[model samples]
Target: MSETSDAPEAPGAAGPPAPPAHPGVGRTVGRMVLALALGVALGALGTATHRTLWHGLPVGLLVALALTASTALLCRAWAGLGTLAAAAVGWLVAVQVLSMQGPGGDVLVTHPAESIPSAWAGIAWTYGGVLLFGVVAFLPGRWFARR
Candidate 1:
């Protein structure tokens, strides 16, 4: 005769960890709001600084793009797709509003056709932010799973 037993592994056992539970609606909403606020701030700051040139290099644009990607990655990793979308929407809204001509006819981000060097920097910053954020949001699902 043979005896066999089936039992679950202990918590400390070496095995893949369970996936994290979905966050509650309230928590999700909170995360979204915070992410959106951060995104808007980044957008404003990026717009203001994207025109800087140091030794003929667009250092400000590069830094702004890096910040945008980092922020989007944090939102995605923290709360998944919805939070990321909220952040992206916030950034887009802020950027678009700021790019528009003000009552006095001043524009934070000028049209690329204006042929100003800063104008190209602004255009790159705008499109580059979107590309970086989208790349972070669409990263492989397994990469974000709990170990």
Candidate 2:
């Protein structure tokens, strides 16, 4: 009769264990900074550049994409950062909105100086960016660590 022994597998025996399902504090903070930086860059782009036939579409679209991807990475990297993630995105949106305003303006925020309807549309577009970020950061995902 053969006897089996209970023992742990050696390093690499399992072919490198999966990375942690949740990122640590450093990683979370780093990602948050990255998100903030990207937001700032996009905001600057909107402010520094003139709106063409493309209008603010290029800036808005880029912001939406960068914010969504970075915030999603933050949430997926760490599971407990729902509020933080959402708030970070909100802050990003706020910065972008405020950037739209000029040095001396009665209104809260405005971009490219459009008419009433177009201005309203721009505001909606800004919020929609936040919404997309929130959806990606808050929605439950299918995959998680085995822990």
Candidate 3:
């Protein structure tokens, strides 16, 4: 009878070693770029159409909220995590842009002290609505997801 080998295969010898568990750097970078681009486009449109409406809110908040909802709806496969991540990334990018702008830009200028509370309230209105849309995206069914 022939002797059987009992040794296990080496780590490097496995069939084409499974690709990295997390997405590749290239893929991650691509997603970030895509998300940033989407945020900018949406922000520009939102700013243009709702200049007065957004005047009461931080652009970062608006961009975050909008991108979150849109990403959630578009990439249902990723669901909650994807929506949150996209929103965060979009917000970061928007914040960077806002910071680079002059003091008169949407994010930095301060209105009346008494109006501070109301301004925050307005920001919450748009921000909450957008976030709610993202949450809805996680729900079942296509029609339901679309908003």
- Model 1, residue 59: distance off in Å is 0.8
> Which prediction has more favorable TM-score, 1 or 3?
1
Could you give the C-alpha RMSD of every candidate to the true structure, in order shown? 5.0, 6.0, 10.3
Candidate 2: tens digits of C-alpha lDDT, residues 93-123: 6556664545676443344454643354345
Q: For residues 1-147, could you state the per-residue lDDT of candidate 3 as single tens digits?
A: 998888998878878656547676787666656655665555444433332346555565566456555655554444334534564456445534543447655543223453654345334534554566456545766554424
TM agreement with the true structure for every prediction: 0.82, 0.48, 0.40
Look at candidate 3 and tell me the lDDT of residue 30.
69
What are the per-model numbers of colliding residue pairs?
A: 0, 0, 0
Runs of candidate 3 with Cα error greater than 4 angstroms are 1-25, 51-68, 77-84, 95-101, 104-126, 133-147
Please report the TM-score between candidate 3 and the true structure: 0.40
Q: Candidate 1, 136: how far from true, in Å?
A: 1.3
Q: Report lDDT (CA) for all predictions.
A: 0.87, 0.53, 0.50
Q: Who wins the TM-score comparison? A: 1
With candidate 3 superimposed using the best TM-score fit, by how many Å does residue 25's alpha carbon deviate from the native? 5.9
